[model samples]
Target: MLPPIPVLADYGISPTHGFLPDVLPLTRLPDPYYNKWEAIAANLQALILSKRLRGVVDRLPVLDTIGLEHDAEWRRAYSLLSFMAHGYIWSGDSPSDRLPPSIAVPLLKISEHLEVPPVATYAAVCLWNFKPLFMDEDIDNLENLATLSTFTGAIDESWFYLVSVAMEARGAPIIPLMLTAIAAAREADAATVTRCLHTFAERLDDLTTLLQRMHESCDPKIFYDRIRPFLAGSKNMADAGLPHGVIYEDGSGKEEYRQYSGGSNAQSSLIQFFDIVLGIEHRPTGEKRGRPQEQGEGHAPAPKHNFLLEMRKYMPGPHARFLNHVQSVANIREFVEEHRDDRPLCIAYDACLAMLRALRDKHIAIVTRYIVLPSKEVRTRSRSRSPEAVRRKINLATASRQQPPGIALDTRGDGKKDSLKGTGGTALISFLKQARDETGEPAVEAWAHRFMSRVIRTEGQGDFFAGKPEEGAGLQVASQTEEAVIPGLAASWTVDDDVGGICYY
Candidate 1:
């Protein structure tokens, strides 16, 4: 039914159970295989720190699965590949957008077998690596899902990953919900479509509500000060922190510092699924749409380089294709339009759109606090003061080894000149700006703007609608506005004229 919602079998403990991957067993590694990979990851981090990652990665022993027969071994392999790939791509003097064969080749083979991607992903960081205390129970039932292992072995790192795991668990039901809708749509069952839309809207609202729970245990101060810094990419991150890189400890007192972007929500499939299902078309940040007259002058496919979509390359292979299918069949609006005579279908569909828009709006708010304000403050002080003073302010040196677990070591002031250029390097601001632009007014205004625009076109035509809403009862449409950038933030934000949504600085 509906192609069984594609699954990457090798990556799952149960290949037939839809998109869920196996969680790491809540126990110790029974052999030396996992420990050996940890050592490799540690050494790779060292090579990255010395600016010699390519030479070593190119010479890495070909991946052998002699000891990788267990779930733990598979998880370790995923972790090892994630470290190697991230180091190769972002540890460069600048961010290398392309994956070199050194990291890509073995990673591709292993990931294809595991049903994941060749790069770091949410699956690598969260899904396949976590271990719940009770094997039979869900991870959300546990207070700690960090018993297995982590790249940096820091509590903050564990916390960062656990948030995603919790969110994934919360949103897991939507998979069946959407798939059921797809089946109903195929049969042209208006009643079934209406029911599914209403359920989908309720689920989306639940997801948005769950998103607010990020603040519950994941303290903002801890996240912004301790955790956020670890997740910074090397792209536009010179001014923020970790100018050279982060020193990862291997527990034997052999600490190795390497430049890395760490894990981020940019790689989250949950958000990507929302984009796919809602028909939210995203362009790369800073790229403007051509005018209507210039739309097809050359008929050449406009080059698209959206960073968010680029992150999909890092998703599990089957997972990425599932999103592709969802996008291809985004027919809720079309179905509703065809059933203009059916008030129930239109109301349910509009409610679904409103919920989706609200989710985007909530994300924009998060980006504002997590990226915009901090970057704005950091850049303002950097410009108004000397380099040394700026460094002192942002780089408050917490004790090196005494740092809490998951807290990344400060790698700045090593007399190393940062080779990456641009303001996004200083903080999360750059990535957040792009994310905000991607999620802003255009997506939020879809149903509201579209429904009104259609109504306007059919004006003076009696009964453009075969059915009307009950008196004083209709779809509640949220308003969109022009993109309003926070003052003095040095982000290259382009607001779409047709969409009205605010990206608060």
Candidate 2:
């Protein structure tokens, strides 16, 4: 018999999408995507109430199960999180305000469990604290970069800024500011110098805040030690093989040393993002060839990037399977009651929030499996059992992980040129509009495949690939992305990337 990996197969990920995490499905959402999310929110709470569901940490005191199922604020936060993860906020004009006040409220509430005091403060801000300062940039042009920093206080709060100054010559204030902060902190005799753990704690607020926003996107295990700790920078990627650590204002090294940051091991894969989109690099059925290099150099092991897997420590079971579907987040009372005193409250919250955040992430994974993963296997029917084939699947998976990320290409092509149409972008929107307009779940999902294919091909193409369609395949490659196939166009379509596939006209 095959291992019970029924859900694992559902995580749509492969070389074409690169290391991109799964997207959540609010696609079942109603039209004007935001409204769809709102409707789903009502239904989500209904489902929770209907089932009388219990979160994994039912014993945690912070949670009040009595009213959670019907909580409006909680439901609102869940809807917004769904927006951030799955809802298409872009109205095709400028970058939509991703972090609304509604989002911020829950975000701060959730951060209690994330990082420690000062350090994680740096990480959370490093990732999100700068959003207000950076979001309004002219998407019409990339060169119109905004001023990087807009806050008062020392370099203590913003570490990535300092790092940028250390690295980028054009960026100023970071070095001079760091020097000034060090001087000030030293004069005051504050423990400006601390460990990476302290730094992570600082960012925990943002981390947990984001968690509360997502409610429970991640599995608990990953949220804590891996995701939140790293966000704080208390832990190095070398823990996952992080490259280095930053120097505090007081000239104290959090560690006697840090890896990947400034050492010989610095700037390594653990810190560098290895995009696994477009086409994944994998070994052939018989022999190995060129593969995407592992996270680090020659002999170093491949890094495990899934933060949720680490959070398994705190979660209960069947519970694991059941909670897999829920992401609104754990109530604080519940979190406190479950782990008890074995771990610090903030750290536990970080773990809790991470799991909540991961629900959206897993949603992305499912998309990759559905859309791009098939770009790999090229099969319609899913093979759940059969040991030999399962062994091959496992072998490929094992090899994909075991072998350095090879630039190996799986040859089973749909033979259709990659396009916006191939990407299902427009089709997705159409499907949402159609399903929402028609009403009834059965009617909506019935033609989902047809809608998905049309959208993937229509909206997914353009710059990610530029090639002519073979006769009838509907692909008309106007331009080929210079940036390799694995990190394909759709794969790299960030707000910054040009080939986002949105047709304004």
Cα lDDT tens digits for candidate 1, 356-471: 66665576565555444543444444556555443333321111112222232223588432222123222223444444444322322355556422312222223556455454
TM-score of 2: 0.20
lDDT tens digits by residue: candidate 2, 1-505: 2122112224322122111112211222232423433443334333232332122112212222122222223323332332221111111111122223233233334332222121222222221222222334421121322222212222321332222211121111122222232233223322331222234233333322322322222232222211222122212221111123222222222323211111110111111111110011111112223443433111112323222122221121222232222111112222223334433443432332232223223333333432233222322222343434433321111211111222222233784333212121222222222322211111112243233224234433343567544563443333332221111111111111112111110
TM-score of each: 0.61, 0.20
Best candidate per lDDT, number? 1
| lDDT, residue 481, candidate 1 | 25
Quote the RMSD, in angstroms, for model 2. Answer: 27.3
Per-candidate total of colliding backbone pairs: 13, 124
Question: Against the hidden true structure, what lDDT does model 2 obtain?
Answer: 0.24
